[model samples]
Structure formats: C-alpha cells, structure tokens
Target: MSMLEPQAPDLRVQKWIGADGESTGPLKLSDLGSGPKILFAFQHWCRGCHVHGFPTLQRLHSALSPRGVGFAVIQTVFEGADENTFEKLRVNQLEYALPVAFGHDEPLVGATLPTFMEDYRTRGTPWFSIIDAGGRIVFSDFHLDADRIVKDLELV
Candidate 1:
C-alpha cells in the first residue's frame, strides 16, 4: 500500500450513513462509483484517529471535493463493537459537520479484523487510501501528505 504500488481492495460496507446523516442500508464495493475516491478508515475510540486522522480527512474533503474528488469515512470495528457502533457514524457526521457518506465495516463471522484491514492489509485505524478514477488504489498508508495527494488528484 505504497505510492508506487496500490491495491484495489473491495469496499464491503455493512451500512452507510447518508448525506442526511441517517442509515442508507447495506452496500457493496461496486456501489461507490468509478472514482478518484478518498476512503479513510477509523475507529471511534482510537486517539490518533480522533486527534489527527479525522481532521486530516475533513481538511482533505474541504480542499479536494470542489475538484470532483469523492470522499468516504469507514469505521472499521476490529475491536470494541460497543464503542464503534453504527450510531457513531451519525455522531461523527454531526460532530464534524460533513455531509459525505460514512460506513460501518465489521469483521466477518469468526474473524478478528474487519474486511478493510484484512483485504487491504491495513495495519490499523487512521489508515487512508486513495483510489484512482478507474478504481485502482493510488495511495494507501497511515500518513497522508495532503499537498501531494491534492497534486496527484489532478492526474486522476
């Protein structure tokens, strides 16, 4: 998941938080359009996600969306389902005041990590991935250089 090599991981979401900040029901990877999409994975209880990741995501959205870049937030609950419940999506939307879609991604039965972490080889929360217009990952990592990503979005 480096800038030189990006993977096309599936976007399997158990539920989506709509623009109105309400449940939109189950969704699949294909539901997201062919896009230059910025997907940030987070956990409600992660300190880094709260202090850094979410703010970066919000900033990126504010800066890049006018250029036609798509954005989404996925709460990948590898642990603490009680803490990272679906309600948090709405809470996050309201708290952040962002109207973009947010998702709930829980682990499959008998699995420990959620699908995003397992399928994308993500290390933990606060992970970010950028998908090209063709749906290929262009950047996937814990750190996001907003200037570089904004520059890269032009090519997509």
Candidate 2:
C-alpha cells in the first residue's frame, strides 16, 4: 500500500516517555497551537535514520522550534528494552533538543511493525508526518529537507 493521504481531524498518537524520561501526551496534533508539528518516526538501528533523518530532524528542530513549531522524534521499536539500551541509542547525535519517544514504552495502540508497514505503506526509516496547528496534516514524506521543510512550514 502507498502512504495514506492526509486525513481530517488530528492523528491520535499514543503517549510515551521521552528520552529524558518525561511523560508526555500522544504527540497530539491539536497541541501544536497555530504553528506546525513535525513528527519523525524512526528506529535507532536504521542506518539511514541515524545518518540522514536525525541530523535533518535536528536542523529542523533548531530552525523551527523557536518559531513556535513543535518538533518530536518517535523512535518506533518492537523490543521493550531498558533505559541503558535506550541511552545507548545515541539520541544525542541529533544535536538538538528534540524529544524522542519509543514504542517499547508506549506501543502504538492497535499498531505493530507489520501493521504500520502496511498502514503507512513504507519500507524505510524516517517516515515523517507534519500536522498544522489546526489539527490537519499538511505534509507527509519519508525523507527530510531542512530548508524546504522550514519554508514549507513557513518558518523562514
């Protein structure tokens, strides 16, 4: 299946603990205020995710966050690892303060690896979903482009 087109209302994400061990909401789409919310879904083991996605995410975070945009990275994983394992995931490599959430701690309700693969219909890492402050998805892609993203978000 291909990526689902942006739908109505807001995507109801599951809440989870951030890399800092802070409890947060399901990355709610409506909480983005009048700005944009960029969600980066990826895994630590994904080489592309680390090499390309994370850095780009960091750039986006640094560029858009001060502009009232909510940037977050959701670390999708099948394993329920401990803090040590998560800490070793190298979240700091992003070089920004973007929060990271794991599926191990906050499994997507009614969604698994196979299911997500079938749902989002992507066979890669760094899947992105950008929701506008009005609780509507304006963009969704599997790759990152810092300048383009900022421009698309109207931050620049």
Candidate 3:
C-alpha cells in the first residue's frame, strides 16, 4: 500500500474529470496507454503548484507530447476541500491550456488521503510521478526538473 518503486503499477486511483470538463471514470494508469507518462499532482489552491508545478509540467508536456509522451493532471485534494473543489479541475486545465486528461482524486471513504497519494507516498502538492513505457515509476517526487527528464528521455 506504500513505498511505490519502479515496477508495474497497481494503480487504484478512483474518480476522474476528463479534459473536456465532464465527469469521467475512475481513471487507471493504463488509460494513459503504453507509452511513457507523466502525472502531475497538485491542489487547486496551492500557490507553488501554479508557480512552479504547472509551468514545469507545461514545459515538459509541450516538449515531450510531440515525441509521444503522455500527460495527465490530478488535483490531489489533501486539504482545503473548499478551495480545491472539483470544479477547479477544468478551470485550471483551461487556464493552463493543457489538453490532457485531468483527474480529481479525493480521499476515499474513511481514507486520509487519495488512493494515488497513498500508493505513491506523495508528500503534498506539486508532485510529479513519471512512468516509463514499461509501466515502471522511474521518478516520483515533489520536485521535478523538466530538464532532467528531457535528458533522461534523450538517453533512453
């Protein structure tokens, strides 16, 4: 349930809001397909997420999506449910102009954090989890430098 590493992911994230601002399914990791993928977790109200996370992810997506990399965004609601409302999912997506699958992950019944946060051991907002084409979590952390990922991709 904890300590996610580089391996086939047992993705259990429940609920999602698709890119087009509509209710969507409980998204699975496989929904991103079999190519390399990036998941950006954030809170709608998190200042750092807007200042650093979104920009970093946007840059990465712009550079990598053309190369066949997949991208998704999740509002990992750990606090301030009032501010991190599900409606913000589309608001942010449109604001950022990120045309990719966006998700809203709230803690399940009786759970303290969302399934993705628990499974990935995410510390807080502005987190990035990178999975390789092999479905392995090659990188998971709060700070992700797009440059590093680009270099890593070039080497791959």
37-104 in candidate 2: lDDT tens per residue? Answer: 77776666667776888788878877787888876555555443343244443444334455544332
Clashing pairs in 3: none
Model 3: lDDT to the true structure: 0.83
Model 3: residues with Cα > 4 Å off, grouped in runs: 1-4
The alpha-carbon lDDT assigned to residue 29 of candidate 2 equals: 49
Whole-structure CA lDDT of model 1 = 0.82
lDDT of model 3 at residue 125? 86
Give the candidates in order of lDDT, highest first. Answer: 3, 1, 2
Assess every candidate by TM-score. 0.88, 0.67, 0.91
- What TM-score does candidate 2 get on C-alpha atoms? 0.67
> Across residues 1-156, which tens digit of lDDT does each residue of candidate 3 receive?
224555745566656677787788777777777788898999998999999999999899888888878788888888998999888888999999898878878898999998779888889989999988888788888897799898777565
Q: In angstroms, how far off is 14's CA in candidate 2?
A: 3.6
In angstroms, how far off is 32's CA in candidate 2?
3.6
The clash tally of candidate 2 reads 0
Which model is ahead, 1 or 3, in terms of lDDT?
A: 3
Off by over 4 Å in 2: 1-5, 8-15, 78-96, 99-123
Candidate 1 C-alpha lDDT tens digits along 1-156 = 565656576776778978798778765555556567888899889899889898888888888888878788889998899999988988888888777889999998898888888877888889998878776777778988887787777666
lDDT of model 3 at position 24: 80
